[model samples]
Target: MSLLSTVRNPHDLKKLTAEDLPALAAEIRDFLIHAVARTGGHLGPNLGAVELTLAIHRVFDSPHDRILWDTGHQSYVHKILTGRADDFVNLRQRGGLSGYPSQAESPHDIIENSHASTALSYADGLARAYALRGESRSVVAVVGDGALTGGMCWEAMNNIAAADRPVIIIVNDNGRSYAPTIGGLADHLASLRLAPEYEQVLDVVKQVLGRTPLVGPPLYDALHGIKRGIKDVIQPQGMFEDLGLKYVGPVDGHDVHALETALRRARDFGGPVIVHCVTRKGFGYPAAEQDDADCFHAVGVIDPSTGKPTAAGGGTSWTSVFADEIVQIGHERPDVVTLTAAMLQPVGLKKFASTFPDRVFDVGIAEQHAVTSAAGLALGGIKPVVCVYATFLNRAFDQVLMDVALHRLPVTFVLDRAGVTGEDGPSHNGMWDMSFLQLVPGLSLAAPRDATTLRAQLREAVAITDGPSVVRFSKGKINADIPAIDRVGTVDVIYRSPEVTPTREVLLVAVGAMAATCLQVAERVASHGIGITVVDPRWVKPLDPVLVDLARAHSLVVTVEDNGRVGGVGSTLAQLLRDADVDVPLRDFGIPQTFLDQGKRDQVMADIGLSAQELARRIVELAASRAPALTTGEAEEETPAGQR
Candidate 1:
């Protein structure tokens, strides 16, 4: 029988001896490799975290003592140790196990939001709360080296160092987040990094010291003091100690016995301590280790042997389209530059960086800094395109509004994954960008309908020299070309129901990826002799003057967008029509203003009533509910727009 089956919870793990831990760590690594390959989750990070998590569970009594994960993608091992190993089959599936740490899943699991550099603050607050209550509870936070790139980590660190309480911070330094970590912190950490041989030699010294009769503890303490002197020879920058936090070793993270000893020292310190554990991202798995792109940071249905993705993906992705188009744009405009928040490859900026290495800047995981830095670049007469996921853009909204938009800088923020991104759960969904970016005055936001529009809109967004512009697109496969019949100002008249004259009953305003769904809805409604006009308003913000007339021409206006309903394109258009004094009743269709759970894109969209069938049925009912006789802005009905 396997060791994992015997240990269902942390209490069971506590029963294992020191010798059993290495075997258990090996088993966990194998388990993660196989399980994550099948279920498709964070493979590399969790693989590296096996021994660290095992040591933590063995040292700290969880549920009573809190253990927090910085960006909870590495919590798969924690979940397995916390009696969730059986749920691996349903990982990231609908109503199944979440990809990150879920408080609802178990009391042992806390801090559900997977945003980086946040756990230190949570740990600080939690530790202070426990200290205030006079309750003795060990609070530990395992933060990735990648998360340290963010400014919030330092802000939290400053506060944490001041507080007089036991809060152990494990800096899991695998040295990459999607790609290798940038900035000085990573380099400083690398200087103090010790080899595995040195750690084993230290362990041997510890064993030899323990065998001594009475001077064992004192000799160990004397040696620990000298270790700092030895470290100063290698790297004098004691970054953690300077912050008023007790600093522990740059210990070999893969060594379970070494990690346990370090953790034990941190647990009993009665104050904030930093345990720097150095390990490889893909420690045991050769495929993941060989993956220089991200060390297989995340995978999707991969073969365990070769670490190749098995899922059949269709044509060109929206990312690839942007990737190719941006490179072309880079060639055309030397003034244009690109920036990413440590996601050089994922956001499809690798080629641009390769082509123009001098221009592209990887600003680490700091989105706020990335926005402001792009502003500085724009201020210096450079047109900077800050590319990031729509969800991460949430972190730098204030910076975008003030630093970029307020100054009227020519910064184009190309937000990939701008709509519902499934499988990564609520935190990863890119459904809020359109709503908030709408609030930024003078900022033009474009929502592309297809690969063709994405390239076109991206070009248009970069050409603007006065104010900040945004060209946001969805995740995954690019939509098929939605050929336009006519261009009404900025709007593209994509579809107009055939054989239905004069009286247009409904106007379907499809934004970005919603064009295909709106077509399906329009077709179903049109089969009943109702003339429905579907237009893709490529640029949503600063509503075109043509849309006001389009709304005036139709009896009912329906706006569809792959964004949150609140203050989205639908609501913005409704407000615009009301401001224009047109009373065309609008039925706005978009995602519900709520946190969506983990599921496939189609499943989540259907559940939120954004499905074609659901929208079509609703539109059909709305047509029947309209006034018996419909009138446009004039008594004479306008001619139906078909292929015009």
Candidate 2:
């Protein structure tokens, strides 16, 4: 039987011989390459960590000896050995295994921090706690070299080194992040990756000297002392040693036996040691290795052989639309500089980066830093356009409030994935951008219903020199190819069927991505002899005065959005109507106050009652209630007229 099929847990893996370990690593890599290609998870990171993971399982007694994976996306191999191999088929699917580490999933997984630069802090806390309680078990933190760029990681490093505790930090340096890591730290890591051959020669010299006789032993010790002195002068990684942490390696991370030996030494030798393991991302997969941009960082269902995407369709996605528009705008305006939180390709800013290399900055997965940096860019008299995922922007709320909004900086924030981003699940959903950004003072937030409006609004956001403005666009294709009107404060009026006469009955105002669904509901309702007024309130925040005025004319008003019901655009509009004392009955349709599961976008939406059929039924029920109220009011008026 193959090593992968035979081994169910780490305990089983520990039983394998040193000769068999390479075959085991090979088996694990093949399984990961096949499984991830079919299910589509974090392929490159997992592929890179196979031998390292094997070495970890062999060296550390996990579930007892705490091995914390930083930014948990790379924990797939860890999961497989911890008795989750059978569950790999349904990886990242609804009700199956999560893409990141979850404490609920296993006892071995102590932290579920999918966000980068958080695992070290967790390791520090656990180590400190263990030290106080007099626990003997070791605490190992596996952090990527890319994650070192984050300020939080350094904060943890400082603390861990100062505490002088038994915390082993395995710096998995594969020289890539979601994209290739940016900043000074990434350059330092590149130097370390190149030093592994020299590191091996030093190890061989040390081993030979240790085996020598009495006089030879003293001479070897002197040579070792000199080597340490020479290392301090010449090594680039001396930064870690200066911080009170012992440094070992530039070790071969792909060689299972070498990694096992280094880890063993680090385990025995105490007080915060960083074993810098050098490995190749997309190591076994030739196609991924050939990929210069992130080595197929996060794949979506692809053929294992060619690494081409399996599913195919033709429609310009919101990301592509944004990329095309931004590139055109950058060409037109010299001051329009772009910024990203380590996402160039995902947010579709690759061409912009290529065109304006100096102007476009990929600020490593540090959202807060990106925002404040944009504020600084604005202060320097440049029009800074900051692009980031909506979920990630939540990390920089304080920066947006204090640095940008308080100063009234003209930073244009282009929020990508502004609605329910399916498949990635709760942590990745962009549903809360409107709800949270609405609370920010002096911030103007708008959403685009179609591609044309998305392009036009993005331009307007950059061109305007007022307070911070944001243009949020959803995932997937635009509803239609209609061009946006240049007017700033106007909302689009769609779904006005000329066949039916207009009535002051029900008005359906939809927000952003939900506009297309609302129009479908309007068409369905019209077929039932009820013509509903379907309007797209493109801009969510600064709740359009025209929407309120139109709602006052209608007897029943319903607001639809793909965000949380509480404090979202729908609730905001409802509050506005109530404050105006319009006396019109209102209903808000949106996502519920609970965490969503990962699944197909349309299927998930339907299950949550956001479909056209569901919304139409609810609207029909609300319309029917008006019959009793109308009858009672008319009868009372007639009686008063008779008495008069």
Candidate 3:
């Protein structure tokens, strides 16, 4: 039987011998490569973290001792050690193992810390709580070099250093978050990665030579006693130690023995400490190691041998469409610039960056800094398009409201994955951007339904020089274009019932990708003698005045969107209608205000009752409910979302 089979938990891991661990580590890498390649979870990050995870578990008792993983994608190995290896078959599927640590899954996990640079703050808080309660528990946070770039990590470190309690911070320095970690911190770590370990095997050999019973004893003696001298000369001190936290490495992250030694010393220090572990991002897998683009950071189901994806995505995605259009825009306008918070390729700005290398700025996982910096760029007459994922943009809301919107800068914010992005869990969903962005006073938000509109709306967003503008799109492939019948101001009427009756029953407002679904609902409702007009208001915010006129012309108004029900486009329009004294009954459908489960996008949408059939049935019920209102001559009742 394999050694991994014998281990069911951290307790079982503690039973393995020193000689047995290397084989166990090997088994884990083999298991991860096969399992992740089959299911398509995070492959490279977990693979690099195997030995480091093993050493951490073996040294510290988990659950009792809080072990936190920042940007929890690196916790797959940690999950395996905590007895979840059997669940790998169903990884990332609905009702299966979450890609990140779920507090419900086990007591070992502190939080669903998928966002980068959060674990340190969690660690600092936990340590403070434990100290006050008289609970003597060890707090350890394993943060990546990539996560370190986020300002919050440094903020937590400042508090942690001031504490009297013991806190072990394991800096998992594989020199990457997604790509090679950029900025000053990367250079500092790179210097330390190149430095030799003072107390390891090579240094021990020097000690042996110094005590040799022969010649060259004097020269060897100098080498033996040169540990501190060499450290002061090569290692750049004061980055961590200067913060009042004791520093204890340049240890090999893959070397279990060395990592354990460093961890034990840090654990015994009885104060805040930093243990730097230098490992490779895709340590054992040659395919991942050789991969320059994100080191295969996140991969789909792949052939284990060549590490190529088995399934191919057939159509052009929204990201690709934006990528192509943005490059064209870059060529046409030299003043146009771009910015990303460490994700240039994922956000579809790589091609733009390559085309105009001087114009693209990667701000290294600092979204707040990226936003304010873009404001600075706009101040210099540069039209900066800040490209970021919708979910990630939530972090920089203040900067958007203050630095950009308040100043009325011409900066354009492009939010990719602006809807229900599934499989990455609730924390990764892009459902909140529209809801939060509604609060920005001068910001204009656009939701494009298809590839053609995406290109057009993106251009429209950039041209708005009066204030900040947002062009948001969903993840995955572009739908077939929903051609507009006519432009009624900012609204595009996509569908209208054949016979326009005097008592118009429904005017459906389709938001972004929900246009197709709304069109389907219109067709479904038409079977029951109900008339509906579907329109796409390309720019959802600053709703066109024509909508109020359209609503007054109809008995019922329905809006469907891909964002959260609260404070989103649907809710915003409801407010607009209510303020305009258009007493026509209105109903809006969207994702309920809740954290959604991980699943296929269609499955999640259907589960949330966002499907066409579900919507059509509700709209029919609402229309039927109003039949009595027309006959009785009573004012129509505004339908509550749940009554149907």
Off by over 4 Å in 3: 197-232, 502-504, 627-644
TM-scores for the candidates: 0.93, 0.92, 0.94
Tens digits of lDDT, candidate 3, 1-644 = 99999999999999998899999999999999998898888888888999999999999999899999987999999999998999989889999999999998988888898889888999999999999999999999999849988999999999999988889999999888788788898888898888665446446765667677664767666864464456667676557877989888888888899889889999988999999998888888999999998887888899999999899775899999999999999999999999998888899988998899999998888999999999999999999999999999999999999999999999999999988899898988898988898899988999999999999999998889999999999888888888999889989999988865546569999999889888889999887788889999998888888999988999888889888877877677777877897778777788877899999888888888888888999788878777545321234254333211
Report how far residue 345 has shifted in candidate 3, in Å.
Answer: 1.1
User: What is the lDDT of every predicted structure here?
Assistant: 0.87, 0.82, 0.87
Backbone clashes (count) for model 2: 0
Model 2 lDDT, full chain set: 0.82
Error of 1 at 482 (Å): 0.9
Model 1 lDDT at residue 267 = 88
lDDT (tens digit, per residue) of candidate 1 on 1-644: 98989999999999988889888888888888898888788999998899999999999999899999988999999999999999998999999999999988999987895989899999999988987899999999999849999999999999999888898999999989888999898888877684334445556667877787687677878877666655456555477888899988778899989899999999888899999998899889999999888999999899998999887776799999999999999999899999999999999999998899998999898999999999999989888999999999999999999999999998999998988899999999998999888899899989999989999999999999889999999888988999999999989999998875555478989999989888898889899888889999899988898999988988888888889888888878878888899987777778877899999999998887788888887677767767533322221232111000
Q: Model 3, residue 253: displacement in angstroms?
A: 0.9
lDDT of 1: 0.87
